[model samples]
Target chain A: MADDIKILAFDVFGTVVDWHRSIMDEVRSMHLDVDADQFALAWRAGYMPAMQKVMSGELGWTLIDDLHRMILDDLLVRFGVTQLSEEQKRHLNKAWHRLGAWPDTVAGLRRLKQRYTICTLSNGNIGLLTNMAKQAGLPWDCVLSAEVFQKYKPDPATYLGVAKIFDVEPGQVMLVAAHQDDLAHARACGLKTAYIERPLEYGASQVKDVSPHPDNTFHARDLEQLAGLLRC
Target chain B: MADDIKILAFDVFGTVVDWHRSIMDEVRSMHLDVDADQFALAWRAGYMPAMQKVMSGELGWTLIDDLHRMILDDLLVRFGVTQLSEEQKRHLNKAWHRLGAWPDTVAGLRRLKQRYTICTLSNGNIGLLTNMAKQAGLPWDCVLSAEVFQKYKPDPATYLGVAKIFDVEPGQVMLVAAHQDDLAHARACGLKTAYIERPLEYGASQVKDVSPHPDNTFHARDLEQLAGLLRC
Candidate 1:
């Protein structure tokens, strides 16, 4: 399955970057009067529903950055944190742009990049991904996003778009993601899938299930292990 | 004019990569029964007319790779060089992906990237830019292309789209390119413009005029000089 894969498209949020920890740290640094873990989880939780709104045409062609701001506005009210000025609120919403990579992300990506064309196939906007990469030294060959296809994940377009962009068959592109549903969709679209275990993706209180799925072409504990498994 | 800049969007073909020399070298290596210089010039000469076809809606939206291949096929026939196999033709068409970076390209980009977000805003496709960056060690913070905008350079949409993607005002972005026409178009879209001198872009036999335009915010001999001018 790995032999034919020339491009490795990664899922960014939980797969490549430690978004939960990053947001929690940012909340702490800003001295926000709220539970960081809960705030991070709440913010992330709003993501899928907001994307669904776009997918359903309730919100027409909204960027992740805009969707994120919309979620932040509601969260600020629910969390009773009304102290921020507009500039502070905008900066806080841009926390996604300053996300920290997982411990092994940079090194593993550097190794994997030597062999495969490594890129981000994330729902994050281009600016978010680009800034995150620069801050975290992600070393992506390309930064592709839902913004590029104007369609979020689970849409066949996002998965197949990677192959189309590279002028290769879908089989030659591999989706390396932590989410089984994402992998399932990519597999259904005839792309190879690699499951990456991001157990602490939701922070210390929540340990995600890291069990192997039979459908995935490969599975590993983290990017480092994935690189080793790929013999990079 | 430079004070507000947050991103540096670049033109890739002749500005970042030595396409003419690279193509000439490839032609020589292939041992084609044609003059290397003539072959290189002929191939590049087809580029604008081909893009014009796409712009005029005669050919629909086509990727630069496909456009390059079409041009190569025509050149092979025009030069009476029909001995190449399909595989050879395909490989030769990908020479753009292997184009050599100008000597100071990587170092200069690295320096500029320290102070501003540096990205490609080229007519080349994503795959081509990504492959070229991987091969040439270009230190672009993001690999962007006309493929993302679905519009070529000099198009207002393409110039304005970079600012939109980065969520910045057009004035916050500086277009760094060798071509005055590209810079002029970018300036018209409210982007700051920096012109780099690429005297031999067409080859040593045909020197490109590198005279300064007063409308440009900055002008330099190369990327390294541009970096110095920006105090990066």
Candidate 2:
């Protein structure tokens, strides 16, 4: 596996960082009189539908940062949180930049870095990724984003963009993600796939029945385990 | 200077990596029966003129990787090195991907990372910068290339593109380079400028007197000195 794989492109939000927990914590700290868990869930819930609009051409080319802000604005209106000022809302929208990594992310990425060129092939914009790296200490060799390709995930362009960025055959670059859809899309584009189990990605309260079965080229409980499996 | 700089977009070739020394070493190792220093110098001398052709509309938009290869191929013919194989030439063309960083680059970048988001704003294509970071341990948070903007450096789009990526004002991003021409171009586009003295960027025998002039917002001897001046 080490000999075959040259680049490891990661799905950042839930796979590398615990975005749900991070958002919930920020909501709690702000004391917005809102359900922190509900706010986190609501924020993530906006992500897919927002991306779908762009993917389906209902919306023009929009960055994840702008999409996130739009969703935040809608969600705030829905929740009737009228007490917050514009500056507070703006700061709250940037909570995505302060996400904490999953427990195994740093160690696993560090281990994998010894053998592979590790990068973020995330839907998150470059600024978000850069700020998150500084906040969380994710040691990516480079941060490759959907923003770079001007396309969202699940698009062939996004998957193929990773291979193009490294100037490698699609087979040489592997997409590591917790989401099966992302892995399947990458596989469709001829990239190797690694499935990581982040069962609590959404939140601990939500029951996610992710199989430990090896559906992809590799399967591991966490990034550290994946690194060990890859013999990094 | 530090307060104003929200993003620090770097010039990769001479500013981040020691291209002259690296190419010279590779040439020496190949034992190609040519003057290694002269070969390296000649190869670099072609860079600006090659970029100028594109910038002036005399040539179509071509990536720096292709531009480097064009220069390399012409140099090979000029030097009468007819013995090289196609595979060797391909490897030689990728020398830009294996450049050695100046001693202070990684350390200074780590420091700068604390204060501002660091990214590459190079004419080199995305593949070249990504591969180079993997090989040379450049700790870039994000890699932005002319490839993304479809325009080479000294183009206002490339300088302004860096600020656009971070959603910052043009005045908030600093262009750091060893070349005064690049700094001047960036400043003309309303970006902050920092000049570093890389007197040996052309080659050892060539005495490059890049003085620390007042034109640049900050001028330093090396990345370490620049980091100190930026208070990073």
The candidate scoring highest on DockQ is 1
Residue-by-residue lDDT tens digits, candidate 2, B1-232: 5787789999999999999999988888888989988999899989999999999999998878888899999999999999899889989889889999999999999899888888999989988998898888788888899988888878899999888888889999999999899999999999999999999888768879987778899989999999999887
Candidate 1 Cα outliers beyond 4 Å, as residue runs:
none
lDDT of 1 by residue, B110-145 (tens): 999999999999999999999999999998889889
Task: Count backbone overlaps in model 2.
Answer: 0
TM-score of each: 0.98, 0.96
**Residue A123's C-alpha lDDT in candidate 2?**
89
- What DockQ number belongs to candidate 2? 0.78
CA deviation > 4 Å runs, candidate 2: B56-60
Each prediction's RMSD to truth? 1.1, 1.6
Worst 10 residues of 1 chain A by lDDT: A1-10
Cα lDDT tens digits, model 1, A86-117, are: 99999999999999988999999999999999
